[model samples]
Target: MGFGAMNLAPVYGRVEESEAADTLLAALDAGFTFVDTADIYGRGSSEDLIGRMLEKRRDEFVLATKFGGNQDSHGILIPGMGRPDYVRRALDASLSRLRADHVDLYYLHRLDPTTPIEETAGVLGELVEAGKIGGYGLSEVSPSTLRRAHAVHPVTALQTEYSPFQRAPEEELIPACAELGVTFVAYSPLGRGLLGGTVRTAADLEEGDWRRGNPRFQGGNLERNVSLADRVATLAAEQGVTTAQLVLAWVIDRGALPIPGTRKAANARANAAAGDLTLDASVFRRLEDIVPRDAAAGAQGNESYLANLDK
Candidate 1:
């Protein structure tokens, strides 16, 4: 398991700097050495927080941050974002905010449709050669894109949203990563808290929480999704574990590196502990039966969000 810093920012709701700092420190202390963040997460706010809070403990963690990505819009595939020159600048900017000489792993947050993936990989390879990044990865890209990018320069990881609610990656992405020796970084492995029963209704989220704007958290969709999650929750109870711990364990069992985000120290510790928890085949079978692949309701994301995925 790894740590996701997106929620450390006020992405889901208001989060104080002290709380965020504690969460980051706690996550590291709790054995989550792989920390993942993005430049666009809070538009640099998340990286800045990580930089300030964890700078002293830098050597203790493997830092990963992404660049050149934007969604929740037209999925325009900004030409400049993918250009070689901009990629260099983005790394420098990320490094500055991360307070690090080089990120252990850097990902292209959005696959640039306008530019050949090979070209982008070439620039990232240059960065690695120049000591700006240890390695480069791709996000929301197709298997073909991964192949093309890996051929140019060895791809380090492939970061995407994966969980029981979002199983599209199982079709091709997981197989390609396994074949190419790439890490399948699973973000939102807990179905963004829905599978954990953390979110029940739209009203369960804060007024400014971004999930409120998500189609999956809206009226009827929220009810249907919660019902599915409840079944999993019941099984989790019978197994004497929190719904979240069960979900996290299942994600690890699936051979993907799950990086779940939380703003609480207790939750961070619990998440890390879940990585070490063992699950039996019976539990896995029950989980699959309760929530099979593609068993989610509502739009996981909007048209713009889907456009950038598997591009």
Candidate 2:
């Protein structure tokens, strides 16, 4: 299992510095071997926090970081990665900020719609030749784009949002990855806490929180989604596990790595424990009916967010 440190570094919450360190320590102590961070996560604070926490035992874990998104840019995100010089500079800067000589996995966070994927991937392949990154990946790309990128270089993984609610990747991306022998790293496997039954209503989120305005968390959709989540909770209770565990079990059972994020130690342990929960084919079949392809009513996010999928 991998830990996502996007919200653990106090950008959206009041997480204390010591608490962040403790969270990382708890994950490490609990046997988490992989961690996912990004240069743009918390404007670089997430990497800094993980860097400080793992300074003494850096070799004990695999570190993954992303580039391609601007740290300070607001409003709608535009596709980037135009200049080869900028890509090289970004990798060097991320290494400097991480206080490490190389990254275990380096992902281009998103494909630059304006630039050719092969060109960007070619430069990334060059970085591997230079020994700056151990493995390379792409996030949120379509099957066509992935095949094009992989043709330029051997892509190690494809990071995307894949859960019960967001199953579009299954229609094409998963099969492509299987054919190409690339790992599918599933991010947001818990549906941003919705599938875990932690969020009941839009009112529960703090002001300015991204989820508060998300379509899936608004009005009737929130109610409907919560109702669906309750069913997952019911099944989890019958299985003597938490809803989080059931969700993670389903994810890993699909043969993709589930990278769920958490700022709390208990949640980390629970998520890690999900690795041992094996769902038989019968159970998976029942779950498919329970959380069908169109189980939820609302969209995963706003139109702009989906638009960035480059479909």
Candidate 3:
């Protein structure tokens, strides 16, 4: 299993430093071999926390982190900054924060429109040659972009949102990755907790929570989504598993390594246990009928967020 460190960031909620460190350690103890993070997450707070907690156990896991988004003075992510110089600088900064000389996998968090993909790939290739990163991946990119980037340097993986609620990648990106022999690393396999059936309403979220602004969690969209999630919960109950476990099982069956983030040790243990819950073909068919593609109420995110995703 892979651990997503996004929840360790304050953007998700108010996570105490001690709790965050313990959470990472808990996940490691649970047999998670891969951990993914990004520089923009809490303006480097996530990486810093990982550095502090896992610096001594670095060899125990494959550490992966992303770069490319420039942050403002307030630590807000200013999207799209993938120039060659910026790429080098970003890797250096991430290495410093992670307290590691080299990361197992480095990702270009978003496609920088200002710079050519070939140029970005070339710099990452150079980094690989320089022994700074073991391999490089791309996030939220398209097949054409992957081909172009891979021409310069082979992409080890493609990170994107893939769950029962978000199946857009399956139509194109999944096939492309399979054809290119690239691993599809799925982030948010639980539909940002919706598929988990834990978030009942907007009030359930903590103050200043980022999900409050997500389209899927607002207005009529949220109401409809809750109903949809209830159906998954029902199925999970029938199978004697959690809604989150069922969702993670489905994502894994689809051939992607899912990185589900959680702050609680119980939730992490539950998520890891889902790796063994195999869904029968009949149940899988029933699941498809329950939550079909495009059944979700809103777009993956707001306009600005969706704009960054390669078409």
Candidate 2 TM-score versus the reference: 0.95
For residue 66, model 1's alpha carbon misses the true position, in angstroms, by: 0.4
lDDT of 3 at 189: 90
**How should the candidates be ordered by lDDT, best one leading?**
3, 1, 2
Clashing residue pair totals per candidate (backbone < 3 A): 0, 0, 0
CA displacement after TM-score superposition, residue 35 of candidate 1 (Å)? 0.4
lDDT of 1 by residue, 117-162 (tens): 8889999999899887899999888999999999999999999999
Residue 207 displacement (Å), model 3: 1.8
Q: Which is superior by TM-score, 2 or 3?
A: 3
Q: lDDT score, residue 236, model 2?
A: 82
- Worst 10-residue lDDT window for candidate 3 reads 71-80
**Per-residue lDDT value at 116 in model 1:** 84
Q: After superposition, how far is residue 23 of candidate 1 from its true place, in Å?
A: 0.9
**Per-model TM values vs. the true structure:** 0.96, 0.95, 0.96
Model 2, 217-310: lDDT tens digits are 8899889889888888888888788998888888888878988887788788888888887767776666667888977878877876666666
